[model samples]
Target: MNTGKAHKSGLRVVASHSSLWGRFLQGDRHAFAEIYEAHIDDLFHYGMHFCQEKERVKDCLQDLFQDLWSSRAHLSPNVLHIRYYLLSSLRRRLLRALRKDRRYQHRESWEAFEFEYTLPQENQLIINETIAEQKRLLHKALSSLTRRQREAIYLRFFQNLRYDEVAEIMSMQVDSVYNTISKAIGLLKKQLPLPLLLLLLGK
Candidate 1:
């Protein structure tokens, strides 16, 4: 299967939950599978951003989907996007997992977590060759940030999360979340050219 095309089509299908929910509730297993395929990568990536450990992220995801499947009859698909719901659920599960594992708790310092995007090696090399200078500057500026600042920026820009959601995920007060993100932007401004800074801000 063309997984990317299938995933996009699944999201389009899921746009109207009332209709899709009806189909799913009426014993359409394919509908559920489509929902799963569309969201698994997003869930995995989001979980990894917070949890860092691959095994923990995988476990959290498995537990989340297992819970969802077990409680499928009670789910209110009309009230929420499954993607957002799963992310929120997985975040909670990760927190619980951290609490249970002392090693994970110790590693909870945001700086210890690294965010990586895995592109095809050839494409990554090509892109790097094309934008080497800009990439270096961007990386330098990013590396200068504290973990909280980096998380705030990534959640706000990369994940398109609202300040409230970022605060919730980061376990900070909403005002604090705003302050962290603002400070991060200020620091980036000092390191980046005006045009590049503007582009980042525009995002």
Candidate 2:
């Protein structure tokens, strides 16, 4: 997920997804299916952060895409980044589904819906030994941060959402999002050794 390359790729993604969104809104079922196929993996992966149940995640996605296709004509006419919009949409629907489930009714803690992100695997590691070790340390440090801290970092950096977009998804003020990410990065810097940031960032 090279960030430098990703940043450039993101621009192309915005254009393509936006065009697909328009086509879908104009009643193109193929365009809608393209949207579903393009984002299903990331949406499902993000949903698992809230609930580990494989079937539940798959069910929710099925329902979401079904409802989305059925109601495509009524959806927004534009979407700048399909990935960002789908991630936020999936998060909302998954939580709503979890809330209705009898087993999770009593456990309403925010930690139950905490964000989870894993470090790049060994094969994805940087070429340098020291940096690779630092990447391992950073993965450990991630566990020590609060849920909100991790979510803020993931949405802002990994998901590439704008600050306001992240704030809306997390239901926080834009300023709060800025502060949270600033603090989260500071904590990561303290937890991670020098020059490992880029390696851990998947650059």
Candidate 3:
């Protein structure tokens, strides 16, 4: 499928972000609301992946937007990607909240980012044994990935973020983000068709 238009649309959003963020920084309430309306769902989805607790994610989102609005004067005027800024801020908040929870203190490894996979009912009937086996193998390959690898893939693919943006959100180097996604794709390729893998990842 031709993706040029989608790419151009993304550029428009980046350009719009520059203007919208400026208004927000200047304490424009309408701009602040628009920013919230545009990103709240994405932020909440990301938050849920970071932490499974629904209420906790909601609380973090509430605090995040509240702080953003209240601290508008101090926020950087150069935020060219509002989604990136919100995602990064929510991540820090979730991590801090997790740290304070005694249940997570002694955990050996953090949970991997979780995303659901479901075949439509009509498609399910048409899917044969071969496809079913491939799906199983794909799940196995995905499950083999490390937590960081899963998070990197989620941010880069599911969130449609650039490597640099994923790096900043995850607090890692850009090269690390590239390598992590490469490795994740490499694993998936071993189990599923390369085209199908890329399609599922929205590449």
Candidate 4:
């Protein structure tokens, strides 16, 4: 899973968000709104992956922004990927909410969270020359993965986060994140032909 180009693209995204965050921290109200608008959809999607209650995720997102604004002075002034920070923050809030509601009292850790990734439409998959047959195989391979494995792969490949960034978001060690994603890919390899596997993953 070589993504040198994708990694470089992440650097560009980092620069973009970091500048916006700096402006927001400087008390620019418009920058703050822009930041919220930029991330709200992504935050909602990521939150849905971890929690079944979509409405709760929406409420938590509202609360997250409220709390962030209230504590703006104490917040980090810059970030490479604002979504990573938002996801990290949102996870804590949602987990606490779960505990408060006694829904996950039996689970002591984040590992108990379940994740599901809905693939884009078949036509969407072909933007990179992937065919309909490849998309079918890719979906099957993705479905075969455990929730944690799928999450690791999603963050590492789909989200284009660095291993360290993914580690922080997923509350895993860097080495562990590497291993998880590697195992996930190994599983996919067993199910897909070599070319199809690379095509599905490399995009």
- Identify the leading candidate in terms of TM-score: 3
Model 4 worst lDDT run, 10 consecutive residues: 108-117
What are the Cα lDDT values of the candidates?
0.67, 0.71, 0.76, 0.72
Ten-residue stretch with the least lDDT total in model 3: 1-10
Off-target runs (Cα >4 Å) in candidate 3 are 1-17, 106-111, 120-125, 129-131, 193-203
Question: What tens digits encode model 3's per-residue C-alpha lDDT throughout 1-203?
Answer: 22222332343334444678888888888988899999988888888778778999999999999999899888777777778888989999999999999997756454558545665555556555556665676677778788888898888777788777888888898777777777676766676776456545542
Q: Candidate 1 lDDT (Cα, whole model)? A: 0.67
Residue by residue across 23-136, what tens digits does model 2's lDDT show?
887878898889888888777766776677789889888888888888876777766777877778777887898888889876634543354455556734536456446545
Backbone clash pairs in model 4 (N, Cα, C under 3 Å; residues 3+ apart or in different chains), count: 0
Worst 10 residues of 1 by lDDT: 1-10
Where model 2 places Cα greater than 4 Å from the true spot, the runs are 1-17, 105-136, 193-203
* Per-residue lDDT of model 1, residues 1-203, tens digit only: 22222222232233463555556656578876777798898778777767677898898888887787777788775744455566678888988888997775555454443544233455555456545566567777767778778767666666666566677777899778777777776776788876555444443
**How many clashing residue pairs appear in each of the predictions shown?**
0, 0, 0, 0
- Deviation of model 4 at 128, angstroms: 21
If scored against the real structure, what TM-score would every candidate get? 0.67, 0.71, 0.79, 0.71
Quick one: ranking by lDDT, best first? 3, 4, 2, 1
- Model 1 ranges with Cα > 4 A deviation: 1-18, 25-27, 108-137, 193-203
Best by lDDT: 3
